[model samples]
Target: MLFVTRSLPSPIWLNGLEALKVTGSKGKGSTSAMIAAILRQLGISTGLYTSPHLLKANERIRIGDRLISDGEMDASLEWMLALRDSYESRHSNDNFGAFEVLTGAALYHFFNQRPETIVCEAGIGGRYDSTRVIPGRITALTSVELEHTELLGNSAELIAYDKADLCPDGGTLVAGKLEDALLPRLRAYCALRSITFVEAAAEISELKYNSAMMQFKMSCAGIDYGTIETGLVGKHQARNAAVAIQAVWHWLQCSKREVEEQRFTRAVREAFKAVRWPGRFERIAEDPETIIDVGHTQLSLHAVAETVREMNSAKPIMLVTGVSYDKNVRGILDELLPIATEVICTRAYHKGSPVETVAALCEAIRRGIVWKSADTIEEAMDLAVSRAREQNMTVLVAGGLFLATEAFVHLSGGDPRLLQFF
Candidate 1:
């Protein structure tokens, strides 16, 4: 509907508020960050907005790598509350969900700042996600994964349909190897919508990431090409970079006349290393080389499992995991169980599935492992972490990001600033 609700007194009209929306199951945060960083390097004022802030609510809004100030957040939130009241009064519709409110604030901030480009990350699904309200030049899918099954659907193809629904008349879709199950549906959607679809080429040969900064040189199929050296961890990250870089490169050719080739490559790489995303397989603490990946969906799980194998020579591992009620407990447990030596299951304390189902699934499929639960996440993770870090082991806090978020804060000694406390 209206990204800027009538009641919302949409941010003051501005000039050159170009937008790019990044939507998909995984890597949306990193992809959006990469795009924004690239645009910023090109000497353009860029605004980057992502959701459910891993570090702080402010992380959801940024003009560049710099976050919006507390004073700015307060002002924006106030404006949004007023808009919510008016929206309820006039149409009696809650167009702005909790996420929508933050998104609107970001748009307002960007609009006011008049950035040359704005890269927006969708909150949930693509079609009706709060961020979809804004018009974007190009739509990029990091990689589709089945998430929010109750809200999206049961199958991977169904999830693709929801995400594909966002490609409007003139917009183009940049994708990195759509999952086999979702390919047919995505093609049908693209054909029906009469939109251009570009499948970004992945260097499948680069099995395991080597070198602190390895150069990935691949040409996008049927599109102008560029290579990027991404420091972001995991093999999946290279694909994410390719998808984002292709989107930026394609968007450049579409919107502008002819641009210098050097400028294009430099823009994409100038802020390469400075783009920081905290909890995507981040090594928060290294005493035991314990890594934290807030990967929830199946695609993300596979990435985490693969990264673990890469790090420890495919060693068997112990995992501390919890998931939201909306995820497929069986699918998640199945994907991870093969790589797991022990699975300590816990519930996110959220409304989705119960911890009992997760625990039950593990015992049935996994051999020689104790399935345990905790009344609270703390108790569950406390037991899980204590067990995993003994020796020659890596403890993975996966499932829900909230599980990783909570563990991070608690392990750092109940630091309230973990939210902003770090």
Candidate 2:
């Protein structure tokens, strides 16, 4: 599977750049962003690579806080496609997927930029993920859940082990909040591999969040980061921030850099507050107070429900949602159906579940809920916004990433099909 990427001429995988690889069922993207933000805040040239961009392919690759320009991305993609074509012509039996090609292109772009550090979020299970080719000395597993059972495994421990493989021997592995039963097994796995394991849950305390922001106290590398506040809305983000802080601390340690407590604390505080990750409980509009959250998993949906309940307990909610075919649709619907007064079932342009399927499941779950179906996200958005304005209800969009992408593109007045790269 990795041969295609490995066979590229002068591949960036051999660049030997310092990297922090993050993998989990959730929070991996947020954690990767936070780590890059902290490094950038501390005067380090940072490159970040995440997956499933909300708007364009450029969002998947970043140098410091800015995304790669369209021209640059196109040039890199052209170069990568040429190399892929040349390789495939010689070896017709083996070829890489779009994600692998994109990963190679992102690494190539990063190599040219010569960033001091790079943070990569794994696209799926980490054992054979394309990003695993990077020699990342600092790795973090944000949270484990039952996901990609066909590729990873059925149990939580199996999924955790598959993700934990991202951490190399003699490197540092940071474990975020995991189930109580899974901790000892993770610890044993780390100990056996001679990896230094740090539990992020143990390092964070006094975690709290509301509609405005999240505040927490973190102690990492023997420094007390007192009273940190982040603009990212959700308690889960607090946990992600903790994992990122620890990963950054270990990254510095790996580079033989000493940290000043006050300066490091200030950098971490500012970086977390300033980091912006779109499609995670993001508010795209006003008047009716529209929010779009790309939480397809049951756990993430539950977090969405918690945040929405905290933000607008008194007002009615108009739920607009669509999930992918592979997701646990019933579990996702179960999390959001209770708080929603009106439901709009819609499908994104790519890999979205059928409107009929989602509406049927919604009906089966709660018969009293008023539900409607839309073949496209635009129609759904128009219908949801109109009804929300009429009844003074909040529009909450939740479900898969593709659905969020389509909704965001529509609400932002962009052509959804125009920027459907990857």
Candidate 3:
């Protein structure tokens, strides 16, 4: 697989690109976007690659604020297809998956653009993820949890160790707030591999939010970053922002770039203000108040539920949700069922759990929740909107990335069927 990437006309490794890889049970995409935003604010050309895009596959590969153009995507895909054919001709048994091809195409596109820095979010565990070929010197492990147990491990320590593989020997691994027991084991694992482990810490205060944005104050590494505001909601985002700042701080030091504290602080402030990541507590409508968040894991779903509870404490909520086939359905339902006055179970067009399955779990967990099932996200949205309008309740679309993407498209007056998954 490495050979295939190396065979590209302009391989990413050969281009002297500085890279940062983010891996975790959650918050990888948001943290990667925040890092790229900070670098761009510092006047550096940056490329960002994140998995499970909200709408189109092109959203996975971005240069600065702009997504990859159709022409660039087509060219890169064509080049990758030729290389894949040639490589598979010689090794007939080995075949490339969609994610591998997409990763290669993104790197190939970045190689042409020649960005000074590239930030990539690992699609899954770091040890076997496709983005591991980036040669990132600085890796950020945002909060760990027991997820992807079959591939990553069953315990928190094992999962943290699996994600720690993103950083190479002599590199830096900056971690977000970790559990007390797991931190020491992760730190020791990094020490064994000669990797510098930096735990990200910040004094976050004055955290408040409204319909439009969230505001907070952060002081990290003995420097006051001042008031930071972002469209992304939730206390977890403040933590993600802290991790992003620390990761970028280490990245600057690793690249031998001058990091004036005042200028860096200013960049962090501006980056948070401008960064816009969709489907993570994003409000797509306001009449009845509809929000879409792509939080599939148990921990992530709990966080989303907590944030929604905080915001709409006085109002009832209409929960329109779905999950992937591989997720812990009952665990995810346990987090959300208590908050939902009315539940609508729906499936995304790709890899979503059956609506009947989610509906059954909802009933088993907490009966009398007034739950209904829809075969598609569109139908779910229609039902949720009608019910919410009559009850004047808030609607939350969550549980999986694909379901959130489909709901986002439907809410934005677009065709959910047109959404791409890779």
What are the models' TM-scores?
Answer: 0.87, 0.93, 0.96
Q: Could you tell me which residue pairs clash in candidate 1?
A: 325-352, 325-353, 417-421, 418-421
Q: Local distance difference test, per candidate?
A: 0.71, 0.85, 0.88
**How big is the RMSD of model 1?**
3.5
Which candidate number has the best TM-score? 3
Clashing residue pairs in candidate 2 are: none
Residues 193-249, candidate 1: write the lDDT tens digits. Answer: 887888877553343444434345544544333455556777787678788778787
Candidate with the larger TM-score of 2 and 3: 3
Q: Is candidate 1 or candidate 2 better by TM-score?
A: 2
Task: Report residue 351 deviation for candidate 1 (angstroms).
Answer: 4.8
Q: Which pairs of residues clash in candidate 3, taking residues 3 or more apart in a chain or in different chains?
A: none
| lDDT of prediction 3 | 0.88
Residue 123 lDDT (model 1): 77
Each candidate structure's count of clashing pairs: 4, 0, 0
